[model samples]
Target: VKEICSYMGVSSDTVYRWVETHEMPVHRMGRLFKFKISEIDAWVKAGGANRKPQKGNSQ
Candidate 1:
């Protein structure tokens, strides 16, 4: 998980927070946290950020 987080340029705490908020794909490996590479891919593809569009903003 640390390795994956490093690859994403985020800290372990950020990943854990994602888990807590159910924002990231993950599973419990027994009593420990586990995340598969596929899961990460899907999560990224599913849109990782939660941003609200600006009012009166034009693209």
Candidate 2:
């Protein structure tokens, strides 16, 4: 989470929110969240991170 936050310039909370609401591709190792740079790049290129949450949803 720390690495990704640095890479993306976003907070850990934002990453967690994206994972929950935007289907950001991530691997779960028990309680740990794992990410691949390639997958993250692809997701970003595909506009995954630019998506807004649905109406009535709160971050």
lDDT for each candidate structure: 0.71, 0.88
Tell me the number of clashing residue pairs for each predicted model.
0, 0
TM-score of each: 0.69, 0.84
**Per-residue accuracy of model 2 over 1-56 as CA lDDT, tens digit each:** 99999999999999999887746889989999999999999999998888887765
Which ten-residue region of model 1 has the weakest summed lDDT? Answer: 50-59
lDDT of 1 by residue, 1-59 (tens): 77878867889888776766666777887878777888788777778634333454432
